[model samples]
Target: MKSYRIIKSPTEGFYKEKGSKFLGFAYHVNSLEDVKNKIELLKKEYYDARHHCYAHLINDGNQKLIRANDDGEPNHSAGDPILGQIRSFDLTNTLVVVVRYFGGTKLGVSGLIHAYKTAAEDALSKAEIEVIQIKQSFVVEYGYEKTNDVLRIINDFGVEINNQEFLAACTLFGRIEPEKYEALKDKLNLVHVKVSKT
Candidate 1:
């Protein structure tokens, strides 16, 4: 299990160099679907922009996903700096997209890198950052006779109950911080409770 920082809300920032304007947007994202949705929305909202360079940092439970697209700019000049800013903040599960509007003047590679980096940094500076525990889901099943014990364990570990079914055997679908999962599972096993990963 690991803890990482993420933006709490959307934020925007702007930077200009030699008449070229870079508008940066930062978002808290949990999945690739969220990334796609925001990218589509931004493209539509800023249709007149010349370039839509972007970067993402996602730390899923099993792996960390990171990518940056330079769009049409010089290779590594746009997206790399944006990704650098994200790493500088030690943040994950976040995306930063920079929309470039040509102002009839061109900024060379160094200038473009500085502009994109500044814009991304400024956007992140305006964001509300939060640290969250990585969690995993599990489905626990036990007879009604052990219902009280199960509830006690759930409450004690502050597990998040996603769903529950009270049938022949009470089944609880929940998520718990990874650090606590093994210990909790062992305790439940002592009571003959079955815990399976969801």
Candidate 2:
């Protein structure tokens, strides 16, 4: 199985039709439940909007699932297009909501589709995406004198420090990238340090 990182921040866009306002919102979420919660929050925030259509794609490394709602748009005009945009980007753990204010002028079926697609694209463009990895944890210990050097080396190596605790003479913490265990051991050994798998 393969894993990838999700978007780092929420994205939003606003568009207008005739005299009506539409707001498109996108969020990178971790789970289906989180997506639902976000949608509810948006609904509350924009209580007067005429419609709140939404879609989401949830990926758990091995499999992916999609869910969406049209709110009150004409059948497939709103939700499906938003969902298609998510799929087109190969994105996961993401949800998008397009809020329409009726605009007084009804955008025909084709116009509505275009509007929804453009809204999704605009929101996606503002998002910052990142890649994340699942890794094991380890604890490395060293004398006080070597602490600074170890910290620098860990930072330079791009390893994540999960937690750190201090004892009388040394620092202990958890780290990731199990494959780098041997390499880290070598670096510590050169500095007269020791590592314990946690």
Q: 146, model 1: CA deviation in Å?
A: 1.7
What's the C-alpha lDDT at position 61 in model 2?
52
Can you write out model 1's per-residue Cα lDDT over 82-164, one digit (the tens) per residue? 99999999899999999999988878899899999999999999999998876789999999889999999888999999999
TM-score of each: 0.86, 0.67
Superposed model 1: Cα runs more than 4 Å off:
60-62
Collision pairs in model 2: 20-103
> Which lDDT tens digits does candidate 2 get at residues 1-198?
234646789999777767767789989987878987998898899999888998889876567868878887888998999999887776778998998888788888888888887788788778888876666577777777788888877786677777776665676676667677788778877878778776
lDDT top scorer: 1
Q: What is the C-alpha RMSD of each candidate to the true structure, in Å?
A: 2.3, 4.9
